[model samples]
Each structure stands twice: as C-alpha cells, then as structure tokens.
Target: MAAGPGRYSKRVRRQQDILQILAQEPTMRVKALAARLEVTTETIRRDLEELAEQGLISRTYGGAMLRAEAEPALSQRERELVKEREAIARSAFRQCAHGKTFMIGSGATTAILAKRLAFELRNVTVIAHSFAVAMALAQNPTIRIIMAPGIYHAGEGAMHGAQTIRFLQDYAADWAILGASALSPDGPSDALFEAADVYGTMLRQASHNMIVADHSKFDRMATARYAQWSEIETLVSDRRPEGPLMRALERREVQFILAEG
Candidate 1:
C-alpha cells in the first residue's frame, strides 16, 4: 500500500532535518544521521537518496553534505526561503501584543514579521531603521511608525550609521525584533559592518531581544558578530538548533522557538 499523506509529510520533514544537520556540521554519516534524528539507518539512506536526486545535497560514500555557495544579494534572499521566513514571522508575531512598542531591524524575515504585525496588531509602535520595514508596517494606520535617521543603504534598503545608533539609545522598547545574516555559536552576525553596529544598538535599546532566522543560517558566520548569545532573549526559527550551537544557547538560557508551518 502507498504511504499516507501524514507519513509523506513526516518524510519531508525528516529530509529537511537532515539538510539542517548537514548545514551545521557540513557532513554526516548515515548511521550518525539516523541516530541524531532517531530513525533507522535504512530510512536515512532513502532520505539521502531522495535529497541527492533533488540536488539539494551531495551524496558521499555513506553520508550527505551541503554544496558550497556564496551568499546572494538582499533582493535574492528576500525571494528565497519564503515558507521558512513566513513561519518564523508568525512565531515572532505572537510576542507583539497590541500596545507594545518595538525596535525592528532590517532583513527579509523581519520585514515579514512587520507585515504580520501590520495586519494583526493594533495600537503598536515600531522604531525601525529599514525603509522596507517601515513601509511594511505603514500598511496599518493604527500602528505608529518611527523611522530612524541615517545614511541610506540602497542595497539593503535600510538606514545605517552613527546617526541611527545614537537615535536608538534615546528610546526604549518592549522588544527588538531583528534578523541575522548568519547565526552561529558566537551569536547572530551580519554581513554589513554598519548594520551590525545598528543591530547591537537596537539590542541595547529594547527590554527584550528576539532574532528571526531560518535553518539556512545555522552555524554560519558573517563579517561582524553583533551580539553575544546571552544578550539575545529569544530565537524563532524553522528548526531547533542542534550540536554545539544548541549547547551554547542553552548555557546562555536563550529561548529557542521552533516555528511550524
């Protein structure tokens, strides 16, 4: 008999979990993958075969690994990872009650969260450095928008510089909702130096700090390491982190929220 829809869904999730694991460690043997995911080695072998056929992963003698690729532009990134980012945005939106104020940072995921807040939240205030973020929240007339002053980065569609950092210091918010170019054991980092500085300042200006990222960012490092693990209050992502990164977050007592689509 054919597998049920539920079983097929489970297999898909398991395959994604395998990809996420490889993203962290670069490679994994079938035996180790089965043990980590709590499935049979034969199951893992079949999954690897499917993944390899899909060209999402490369197959080795007894394992699978991620193919190395350079980072894409901001426009490209926003178009990629649509489902994962939407799930992350939904999970992060739960923290935004009607009357709370937030310091929102720039990124594809954060923009999605802003759109969610605009649609579902009322009487909220958002202080943001990104033009895209501001425009997204502007859709809701009830939500007040405060755009930071700084040098505009056309590529990122965001504001960054000393002006933005200094402006953030003057106000406090309930939460700082941000995104990461890369999230590693060291913490969340960004590719832009000025943007990293702005994010770090936002973290300080808020009572609680939350990062919205996808599994693709796991175990990756960028140009600037913005905040230490302890500085972040929560992480909402498509998958729960594993290995040393999980241990690091646990040691710092960061809340890990898994977003289910």
Candidate 2:
C-alpha cells in the first residue's frame, strides 16, 4: 500500500501537494507554492526541477506550468475519463431510436456510443469513417455499417482524405452524430485539419446534427470548424457548460443534455 503523507517521504508528499495546487491553478510561482506547502523556497525549486525533469510540469519564469501534453492520447483519454464518456454516450444513445440512420463520426466518446448502439439497439444503419466505430458494431449483423473510403489515419482510428470528403458530400443522413477534438460556443472544431473538410461535408449533408463531447473539450481549441452552434440540434455531454459557451447554447436554443458521470 502507498504510504500516507506522514509515513511517506517529504519529497513524495510535497510533489503530491504541488500537483494538487497545479490542478486548481494551471501555473504557480515557486514562492507561492513554497508558502502554500509550508516549505522553503529552495525546496520548492528543487521539487519543481524534479517534476520538470520527469515531464510532470514545465518550468517558467519563477514558476511552473502544468504539462498538458503529459496527458496521454486517445487511449489515455479512454482510460482516464472512460466513465464520463460512457455516461455521455448513454445519454446520447437515447436519441438513437431503433431504425434511425445516422452518420457517426470518429472520436473516443463516439466510440462508446458505437458499442451501445451495437449491443443495445437494433436495426440501425451507421455511415462512419472511423475504423473503431465500424469494428465496435461489427459483431451485430443487424446493424448495417457503411464505411467511407479514404486514407486510414492510425492515430485517429479513422479514414480521411479527399475521397472521404467527396463521399460525405454525395451522401445524406437523418442525422450527423459527431464528436469534436475541441468545442466552444463558436461551435465544434477538429484537431485534424486534414479531415476537417470531411467532417464539414458530413455535417452539411445531414438533416440534423448532434454533438457528444465531454466538458474537458468545452473551451479547447482546434484547427478547423465542423458545425456552428446554429447547425447543431442537440449537445450531449457529461456536464452542463459554463461561461460564454453556455450563453451561446441558450441563445441558439440548442437542446443540451447532461449525462450522469
């Protein structure tokens, strides 16, 4: 078992305290951290140095910033926030009425929705670009899966290219159930600019749009826009939004659904 703060080494305790502070505040000055942790400034500096060397944080001018990049990729996302995504997907799945046809997009949250639709729902046709989405539904013979042809993107677990965009342009769906790498009141955006055109085309071709994303993506930035707030019919997520994004959703009259986390 891991030792308590008193039983463990001071170095371990101090580092844990440092991470807790950083979690509340993205950046912290060494002097402030020292005072908060009731440690000498020199000790705080050493801790910061060790954390930086371990890539836990980034050293700044007289301070350290949280190393957001230290967080792992999609699989890491699935592992860390899997429950939240699963709950959000469950809430989003309620909209997936049996016999409804939709074009589902690639993303971790959407991947969860794919599993639910595959096992829990029936007789649904899904046009998707994600290999993950396709494979998730592969076991169910009742669910028809249509793959959009394109160059496979290993990192995204999906396919995308000019061909994918062309196919999306030619196709239409009852709804475009999508996901975003980042989102704001400005609407949903994609981190993969190469596939942004394909997402945009898919969005336009669909009669209605639903976005399933977690609150962590609320204010995050991405390269290209997929759909505007006005374009989306519903927003499904783990938590209700805050700040400017919240106001925008209200003004647009978008139906926002919160899933239990």
Candidate 3:
C-alpha cells in the first residue's frame, strides 16, 4: 500500500523511512529496523542490500550504517526527522507548563519546541542561545525571549563559547529544554566543543533538565559529553530505547517518555 501524500509502494516508502532514520543515527541494526518498520529481518536485509548497492548505506554483520561524513547537514537533518522531532518536542513542551522561565538550547528538536511556545505557551520567560529558537518565540505576545551572549555559530544555528557560558551563569531557570547532536548509552552529547560548553552551562543553570531526542540518537556518536544519565530528570523521544539503554536510564532514575506520532 502507498503511504503519505505520494503514491509510494511498500518497498519505496520503507526505503524512504530508512533514510530518515539513518539521517538521525548513522547506524541501524536490521532487527531494530525491522521491528520499527513492521517488517521481517529478511525484508530489511533485502532493503539494506538494495540501499547498499545504490551507495546509500554500507552493510554490517546484521545491519547497515551510514558513513560518518554521510550524515545530513543541519538543514537536511531537520527536514528528515520532522515527524519524530515533532512528537518528541510535544512531550518535552508539556513538561515546562508549570515553569515561568526556561533555558532552551539549539537544534532541530529544540526549534520545534520553540514554535509550540510561541503559539501556545502563556506568560513565560525564555533564556535562549539559538537564533532560530528566538525567532520562533518572537511570534508570541507574552513570552519574553532573552538571547545569551556569545559568538553565533551559523552552522549549528546556535550561540556558544565562553561568553555564552558567562551569560548563562548569571541566571537560573526553572527548566532547561535541550537537544543532543548525538546520544549514546553514555548520555547526551554534542560533537562541537563550544556547544558542549553552552549545554553544560544550560544543564546547571536550570533546576530541571529535559532531554528531547529521537530514537535514532541512540545509534549516533559524539565526543563532547554534556551530562550524565543521572543528571537528566526526563528524556522525551519519538520511540522507546532498547533494553540496555532503557535499563541504564531507569537505573539512573531518569523519567523516559516515548512520544506517540
């Protein structure tokens, strides 16, 4: 059967979905993809083979992975993960309902949450470091937007560096709504050093921290560690994580929420 607005077959639609998943996380196990897509392992294997032949993915022992540099650029990443991020953001946004002020960071996921606040949230103040986020909240009449001082990194669509940390240090917020460049069992992280520093400050400056990441973030990797699993009060994602990662989050007492599409 065809899916979405386009007349796409089962195979083509599945392949398209696979690319979006790969855009978020470079690697994907065949079994996991099969479960998520509601297909058999053999079917996923066949799809992987086709994608590999087309130079879209490289096959692994039981799965496939995108080349490190093959990950989508900032704009592309946002476009591909639209549905997942929307779901994740909706859940994360609800958590900040009781708070009067927030410390929101950058990224596609954060941007979605920003839009919700601009349209729906009332009488709130936001301390933000991302230009994209600021623009979104500007549409609302009540929410106050504070831009953190720093060098704006256009590539990340956010601000970072020593100045940002210094600026964030001067204030405390009720909640910090943030995103990860990549997430692993180690916790949430970003590949950029400056971003890591800014997020680290955001984590401490807020009394509560809620992480919004799509499930694909689990298979992604990044160098700069921003917070430990225990440090996160809640994690909202498009899908539930696998067993070990789920267990780890539970052990750390992080409230994990799977946002439905």
On lDDT, the leading prediction is 1
Ranking by TM-score: 1, 3, 2
Query: Rank by lDDT, descending?
Result: 1, 3, 2
Tens digits of per-residue lDDT for model 1, 127-191? 99998899899999999999999999988999999998889899999899889887767688887
The TM-score obtained by model 3 is 0.73
Worst 10 residues of 1 by lDDT: 65-74
Q: Candidate 3, residues 70-174: lDDT per residue as tens digits?
A: 334467677877988988877887887788889998888898899988878888999999888898899997988999888978777778888889999999999
Error of 1 at 116 (Å): 0.4
Could you give me the TM-score of model 1 versus the true structure? 0.74
Model 3 Cα RMSD, 1 decimal: 9.6
lDDT of each: 0.86, 0.79, 0.81
Model 1 bad stretches (over 4 Å): 1-70
